[model samples]
Target: MSTAEAGRGPRLVPVRAADGRVGWSLVAANGRRLAAAVRSYRSDRELASGICELLAERAVLRFVLSQREDRLWIWTAHLPARSTRAGAGGGEAVARSARGYLRRDQCRQSVAAFRQGADHVQRLRRLAGGAFPSSAW
Candidate 1:
């Protein structure tokens, strides 16, 4: 594991594949360590929606079972603009629309959609009975 400092208290370590893709782990001052990998796909709204469904499963498992507030935050990090089209406020607009329909107070649905867009890597981790540590979301 390679380590670098993140801000004041935590350290970040990257978990890399032979192909050079990286997943990360965050080590906090209190000894809490979280790790997760990130992956991006071609911009397709349908694929994005499917990812959200998978993430909802993970959120239920991670947050509800572990009682972790950080799960929601980690879930959001999975979304990043993968294409210029999606980047031109499209992804954000989609997310905003989802949130609007779900109602802001319904944290579960909001998080579920975020998973759809960004949390496939985490879903894999969950399937393997593991967790991804992320600072995004």
Candidate 2:
């Protein structure tokens, strides 16, 4: 039986990225990644809070697992919060589609990454003189 189906399902795991960056991801039971941080986080606390916020805001997330090129893989997406309140007085819904993961697992991770990516883009806009180039390290 798939580990996920064996009562474990998907879970958020603390990840120390290959470049030594740190973040969180919701992984399948087989230890395959479902979704992950777009970049990385400076601290674990930030990562935890980030994941929590993602769950609270986003309403849709997608995870796919399959075999490709002789390897098992995952693809994931975290769609933006739905605009249930849209109406004549409301402006047109802004487009927000953030997909992550060289490996994808589940919806929660995708949402977290989406919001995290938005935060990174905002950081880019506020870059000052010689402010470390980019959010990517």
Q: Residue-wise lDDT of candidate 1 within 38-112, one digit each (tens)?
A: 442333343344344434544343322112343322223323334776435423211211112223345555445
| Local distance difference test values of all predictions, in order | 0.37, 0.44
**Taking the tens digit of each residue's C-alpha lDDT, what string does model 2 give over 41-82?**
677667655554555443444433344574534343443544
Backbone clash pairs in model 1 (N, Cα, C under 3 Å; residues 3+ apart or in different chains), count: 10
Superposed on all Cα atoms, the candidates' RMSDs to the truth, in angstroms, are 14.7, 13.8
TM-scores of all models? Answer: 0.27, 0.39
lDDT of 2 at 32: 56
> What TM-score does model 2 achieve against the real structure?
0.39
Top-TM-score structure, candidate number: 2
